[model samples]
Target: MALSHSLIQLLISLRRQKFIGAGEPIRMLEFGEQNWFYDVVPAELLILIDEFQDVPAERRQALKAELQQILDTKPPTEPFDICKVFYKLVFNYEDYTAVDLHGTPQALSLDLNEPLGLPPHSWDVVTNIGTTEHVFNQYQAFKSLHELTKPGGVIMHSLPNQGCFDHGFFNYHPTFFYDLAEANRYEIVALVYADCSKHPHQLKQLGSQADYVRLAVSHQLSAYSGIFCVYRTPTDAQAFKVPRQGYYDNRLPPELQQAWQNLAR
Candidate 1:
């Protein structure tokens, strides 16, 4: 069952406590200040940034110039924890080892296509914000995330909704809500929408008053509208399920059972 916003917040609070006591500081990669990082501290922290050619040509060039300037200047405080950041030019299977950046050793920059080989139940929290939609195989990604997290671990994710403009890259997909739940075998804890028009480009696209209204209404009705779901990993028995079988049996109160029979028929 999907979780209410209040229940989701409560779980986040509880997770924060356990995460604090885990003896290591919170470790976040590929996520930034927009996340819940301020709430927890880890003994060691690492961040990874992956670059891709899918970005707009102009923006890509501008970012490259910006990065070169930043690299030359060596700013006083690193934008993220730990020293190095990675730029993977191509997807390769054997590049999963740590890399040396700014004199620090951190895990090799991860490509969504590659596996980390992390044991099941290793992470306390995993967050993927606006990243999964870019992946070609979202189901495999979710399965990998499920395996990477410790039991009772949580995944915080945000997906784009309808009415979002195509940015020339494969930025959108349909039916992720149902797919993610089944893929990770997780119960959704919360679902919320994020107004992407808050970004200038999106807002500009809705130039006229009528256009803005249409966009707004479409966003409101979309099932994909930026969702935030928190799930507790099920126990082995609960997690295990056979293919082509109903997880819930038909035996129940007469009224409930009758409803189930009607649906089955």
Candidate 2:
């Protein structure tokens, strides 16, 4: 998975809202060794970075230099490591780990089908960016995120919601997250749908978990979209909560089901 401009904005917004790095360094575990997809940083991102108030002046200057180097070198897109460079420079993380099936020879080979078996509840932020859809065993793919995150920490997922044919083993629906968060008792931080057919920043927020079905029927949204779900794990540690589909168990209202049925006709 690659880091797009929108993902950068989301991370920065989380920090601004004091969800992360309120007064401490971040410990982030990403599902993949993400890279910045663009050679030059987008202006929107630079503006946000300049406005960020948490970083000390010297650290900010260092960040400026790091970004300048990216522009100066115009590094090749492959193996640029821009995502790692930016996150490390900007957050100055306490720890950062990337688990992937492929990486440097020294990097551990990971299969998403099994638990990471890392120290339980060790990470402050865990991300599944564009990874789980490729895994056939979806349960294990998501359970690993639950196991790795510290209680009260955050878990973020960005996956294809609509119109990515044959790109992976499966695509996601917003209701999947609604049920997952409902079952796990995760605090809903943000739920957004992005029009990813073009630039990555075109996002539309889903007001609440209920809005997943509500908006789908009301707006008739059928685009090449990506679902971005950010949840704060419950403060009390617990086992992974298995979820049932919302409509099947009356978790979603009958009106929403009727509306969806009408839309299908």
All candidates' TM-scores? 0.45, 0.87
Query: What tens-digit string does per-residue lDDT give for candidate 1 at 1-265?
Result: 1122322333334344542222333333322112122222211111111233343466445444554555566464333321222111111111222211221234344555455565556555565555555566654566666666666655656545555456222443222443445544765654444343442112122222233234444544332234444465654423432222222432234543343455322
Query: Candidate 2's residue-wise lDDT over 59-176, tens digit each?
Result: 6677667666766676664343556556754555777888877654434578888877788899888988898988888899888899899999889899998888898998888778
Q: lDDT for each of the candidates? A: 0.39, 0.76
Q: What's every prediction's RMSD, in angstroms?
A: 14.4, 2.7
Model 1 worst lDDT run, 10 consecutive residues: 86-95
TM-score (C-alpha) between model 1 and the true structure:
0.45
Off by over 4 Å in 1: 1-77, 81-107, 168-175, 182-185, 198-225, 237-265
In terms of lDDT, the best-performing candidate is 2
The positional error of residue 242 in candidate 2, measured at the CA in angstroms, is: 1.0
**Candidate 1 local Cα displacement, residue 265, angstroms:** 27
